[model samples]
Target: MSIVTTAQAVPSRLFAIYAALFESETGEIKDRIEAWATPPSLSGRGADDDGESTTTLFNNTLQEARRIGLVEDIDDKLRLTADARGGGKKVRDSEVYFLDYMRRTLFDPARALETQQSGFMIALTWFLSSSPLRPMNFSEPPQVGMRAQIGDHAPKTELTSLNRYQNFLYWARYLGFATIVGGRDADDQNARRVIPDPVRAIEGALPAVFAEGNDLPIEQFLTRLSGIFPVFEKGSVREDYEAMLLIPVPDPGQRLSITTSIALQRLADRQRIALTSLADAPTRILDFGSREGRVSHVALRA
Candidate 1:
């Protein structure tokens, strides 16, 4: 798509495409390519051929990305470009810039609402809730704990995924939702150590702990009670099982004495904010085209 080199608001299509192509060296055909490639693929799930489902908002966003210059066209193949660089601040390509724009516009707003409801603690909880794997997979058939491969769907344990989780934790602590209960003071140091017990403990309990609505105060909710969970050591679900045999609750937190009514009210407020962000964040697809035929098309968003 042709983009006017102007300083007006960045086109959403260009922004989406740029975001998708920011770090990648290649191009893609559709913006929602990741979603299309994900489990329960969104290809044929859409109504039209080439998986273009008007009903599928992502498919529609991909079309919009095509309209922006972030995607280049050669024959049937589409190419994308990286963010524009060399300003005092780096100038990202349209797609990369678009992704950042989306984050700032939509995601940021949702987070703002969430913070208002429950400070920043809710952000960490929401981030964990959004982890790639089913946090409560242990409750499922075959009863496993954080397996590398669970049937067909694989858990994303890559550094990129880990970085995303760590970023959330970093931001949480920076904002005060998390306090360094243990470990060193350096930013990455605490992340590297065992101080962030809440992440693992909460992951272990989330599928069941928050399964049903319970009235609980924001500060005292036992989302990560240690005694009620099983810990998964790195690379060892078997070790997790053995460990569970040794200690039922490996990292339980102090219990609060607040009445259920007060806790329930706060929980309700936080949940409303969390659910609202989930509902509002636009999951648009971002496609881009590249000038180089070798790295022709790229997709991002969703």
Candidate 2:
């Protein structure tokens, strides 16, 4: 007898559909359109039109889920694939637990950095990852004018945080995460729109990867950038103005990847939303929103 393992339940508003698909005696998942979606009762006042929309949402979710191997379609039947194990390990359980501990405890490494309130390390990590080297050289300062002077087309700057942000914007532009507008005034302050592609992709994908009830750290997303390039190791060169660590791009096309820009925008948006939501709560809190918004707005404008 096959031991029936309880499936790792899928989420989103489509959970009802998932439940229905799994509830049948044989727990089969796919069939003709009507099986999974019969319209929800529209009779009651304020009853949302969920029937058709839920199916559409489920269809999108299921297609992506299948693509990522969390589930599969066998003979047009959707079934929990045996391969759907532990959400595919983007951040391991230990890491998630550690993040939680850091958020709650005084000695958390995250708190150490948060207390400093400087994004220097984070920016450095990103810079090293995206560069040709794995470590920064403390011996010499980065050549700010090198890219233009050398006609290399790559930006070189000593402002690590800002440079890192620009690199991310470039990648995001390449990946269709956001669109860049060329026209701007002399001071360079103008509106830049962050297209919704990156947010849609993450909103669709993250739930499949993270465990139920687990909120992945925003820093965890930063780690994903490192996967494209390695930043930390001892032998990497360091000059006073810049550090030259040898980091290799695993995928050559990463130079063209704009996915990061989209993600960064989405991250900025979420932070804004969180702050706004917090403002509605019954507590006196410092308004960091204005400053953060201005900084992000300027970055995107660039």
Candidate 3:
């Protein structure tokens, strides 16, 4: 029905689909979409056929690709758009195009209240609002504690299953917004909790944020950044969530969420950016745990 129900909506499956059909050259019959996930040897059917399952996976993924505008069914043929041909001849190793397009389509503000993406936005916004030092247990649906937050603005059916939650985690990492950490070996997935560190996502948006110049004042940077991801503090998604809250968020007295601030600090540590303070200049505070600091300007270096 939606990506929330399409459990294997992972990037690798998307890449596999792109690699398989990007070369339709003339036209790829829509049915061929399933061939990508169903190899000849396993194509047998009727009884013990495992092929139907394979085809289902790609079909589900195809719907998502269609949803995100990466490819389309035109005149009964599958056509890869200019987006899929991004690398000129090869499938990109990075999901940059996929994610960028998703940001423009699936994650667009218009769909924020729909189940297709509202689930992700709700879960992510919750993660962003949380403290990085006290990571909330991903084992529980974030909305549990914040039931008051999404009390009723929730889409027709809230995406609340543990399985759908996993799908949320998958998309979050693929889109470069969140990460899971902790557990036995730190690699123990079942025990991992999602952390709101959109470092990579934020890092990629710097160029556009500083489009006119290499450096931008804090306010300008926040505007551009929030424009790219409206789920951030002071953004549309946050406003929507706040509007539904049974109790307003206790004023943090700062615009940046703790999780977002942690991400920016991580970016600074990576030398991908520079956060500077200037005398007599309007500034904003980045409250990352106990390391609170103010910045007047941001400069991109990497």
Best by lDDT: 3
What lDDT would candidate 2 get against the real structure?
0.32
List the candidates' TM-scores in order.
Answer: 0.21, 0.24, 0.82
Off by over 4 Å in 1: 1-17, 29-41, 46-55, 75-77, 81-96, 99-302
At residue 8, what lDDT does model 1 achieve? 19
RMSD of each: 21.9, 18.6, 3.9
Decide which is better by lDDT, 1 or 2. Answer: 2
Rank order (by TM-score, best first): 3, 2, 1
Model 1 agreement with the true structure over 90-135: per-residue lDDT tens digits: 3434333443332332223243333221112222222222222122
lDDT of 3: 0.69
lDDT of 1 at 16: 45
| Residue 250 accuracy (lDDT) in model 2 | 31
lDDT of 2 by residue, 190-255 (tens): 434333234433333333334332333323332332322222221111121133223333333212
Q: Which candidate has the highest TM-score of all?
A: 3
RMSD of 3: 3.9
**Backbone clash count for every predicted candidate, in the order shown:** 40, 29, 0
Q: Return the lDDT, model 2, position 45.
A: 29
